[model samples]
Structure formats: structure tokens, C-alpha cells
Target: MKKFIIGLFALVGFSAQAAIINISTDQASYNVGDTITANVWIDIVELQGSNLAQPFIGGFVMSLMADATSLSYNDGSIMFGDKLGAGALSALLPVGFGVYSIQSAAFTPSVFTLQAGLTSFELFSLEFTALSSVSDALFGLTASVSEFGSFVGTPVSTASTEFSVEATSVPAPSTGVLALLACFGMMVSRVKARR
Candidate 1:
């Protein structure tokens, strides 16, 4: 039993060393409101499956702020495709190590508009909080951008393309203004008659 325990400890240390997290963005600097897409992934190629479902990977969505007063919340939703059958399963990259398919898609140009002048980094939370489950511990995360009117594109190795959303807050001329002007003209005529 003592020998078995020692061997297990060594194995665990080796496995932990094998697991690493890598994050990359297409663009580094983003405007306060610019919509940017980022990709996250891992390096392992094979994972053994368990008979049960497991959470192997996930990510934190955040945006960098320009200033305290210049930051605002950008609202968006996350959707995961290619749902796997729940069970003890091993995950193999559709491609190979350091390569992966799109597990989730993010709508870009940001479906949500940010507050004007609020330049800060904000993380959009995931709708599906669970990560992909594989037989082993090698896990990775990635993001696909879906701008305001578009959908996600094909998967790639790196995340890039950082930008900002411009705030549009102009009020158009209202019918109320025209009515006020007419009323003022009528008052002026009445005053002129009295004089």
C-alpha cells in the first residue's frame, strides 16, 4: 500500500505539470467601446473519458477600462454548439494537439452597446457556465466573435482583432418642438394686437 501511494503521488505531480492554460487575443489595444474578439485554448491532445460528465474548461469574459468614469457594461450573450453526449468520455480535437474546432460562438461588434466614453475592460459572462469534458485533464477555451449583425466565423489557433464601439446618442428633432414654436407665434400676434 505504501508503494502504491508513492507511485500515485508521482503520477499526479506529472499530470499537473502537463496541464497548462494559454490565452491570446487578436488585438491587444481596444477602444473604450470597440468590440474585440479573443480566443483561449490549451496544448494537450488526448484526454481519457470517465463514465460521467465533467467540467474540464471555462473562461472569464472581461474588458479593459480606459478610466473609472469612462467604463460601462457591454451586454452580450454566449452560446455553445456541438453539445456532447453526457457520460464519462474522452475528448479528441477534431483536428489535433494545439488545434480545435469552435465549441462556442460569440456575437461581435457587440450585440450590446456600451455606455459612451466608458473605456474599460469588461467581461461578458457565459450563458453556459460548464466547460467541455474529456477523459483527461488537458483543457482549453476559445471565443468566436459575432458583431452586432453578424454570426461567428470558422475556428482559428489565436484570438485577435480588438476594437471599440462608437456611442451614438443624438436626439432627432421632435414634433413637440414644432408645436411649441407655433404656440409662441400665436402669443406674439396677440401681444401685437393689444399694442
Candidate 2:
């Protein structure tokens, strides 16, 4: 039967090229000496047999670390690891500043498959501006692969993304003196209704 119709068209072309890889960060709501600006993206979604290859080799790279307690991995003056490229995604900058180092090594992963199922997707966005008196700050994302050879069919795994840092509020001073006494009572009731 023609080899079962060419094995059903090669199993529907390897399920239309398998895919799944992600990283995210673009102001999910932060306020505390804010300075969060991140943007990183790399998507392939799915690909295997259909062959949609174009520099597709276990990939991911981007960095910006911060910590002020509870980072986990070790801390030391946090702020070091800024290398983005795996065909480059997108990066803004400014990440949790001052008093942020519990454990951070944001964006640092670039795996290019020498062989194996192949998969790569990373996305990080940005926009953070808060710094009044400080409240909290901690951001992270770590994937590794700049050098470590060994693979013939499937080896490319490195991905991480963490976030925390908030403080950008204003509404005190008696609420701006009650909004200037309700705009001076609506301008004295429109100057007595224009007489």
C-alpha cells in the first residue's frame, strides 16, 4: 500500500515540528525603588523532521542579575552577567538596583545543540521605574552553556527567569491636601454661577 502511504506522510511531518521554550519579564507589576527594564525573546515553537532549521541549536542567552536577600545560589554585590545572543532576542536593561542580592545571576544561558531533538525559546521584556524609599527587589533567570561539549542527538537545556522589585507609588500628603480642597470647591461654585 505504498508503505502505508509513506508512513502517513512521515507522521504528519513530525507533528509539525515540536516546540516549547520560554522566558518572561516586562513589568508584571513592580514598585520599590523600581528600575526594571527587560526584554528578551527567542521562539521556535516546534520543528523536527519537517526541517525548518535556521541556526537552531539548543540556544538561549541574556543576563542581568540582582539580589537583596533570598536569591539562592550565593550572593556577592549582585550585578554581573549581561550577555544576550542566541540570534539575540531583545533586552532593555536596568534591573533591581541597590539592596538586592539574595541570589541573582539573571540571563546567562546559551545552548546550541550539537545533536538531539533541538529546542529553543526565550522571552524577557522590560519597563521598571520606582525608587522612592525602597520596599523590595529581586530578579533572576539563569540558563548555562558557553562551553561544555558533548552531544550527538539531544542536548540543549538551560532556562531560568525570576522577578521581584516593587515601589512606585504616590498618594499621601493628606492625599494632596484633599485634592486642593476639591479644586477650591469647584472654583467657588463657578463664581456664584456667574451671578
- Best model per TM-score: 2
Model 2, residue 40: distance off in Å is 1.2
Candidate 1 lDDT over residue span 1-195, tens digit each: 999999999989878632222343444433334433443333322111242322222222212212113222222432222211122122212343233333332323221332122222222222111122212212234433222233333232323222233343457779999899999999999999999
Q: lDDT by residue for model 2 over 120-195, one digit each (tens)?
A: 3333343334433334444444433222232232322333455655444576678888999999999999999998
What TM-scores do the predictions have? 0.23, 0.25
- Against the true structure, candidate 2 reaches a TM-score of 0.25
Cα lDDT of model 2 overall?
0.41
Q: RMSDs, each prediction?
A: 20.6, 14.8
In Å, residue 168's CA in model 1 sits off its true spot by 2.0
How far residue 159's Cα lies from its native spot in candidate 1, in Å, is: 1.6
In model 1, which runs have C-alpha deviations exceeding 4 angstroms?
A: 1-76, 86-156, 172-195
The per-model lDDT (C-alpha) reads 0.33, 0.41
CA displacement after TM-score superposition, residue 19 of candidate 1 (Å): 22
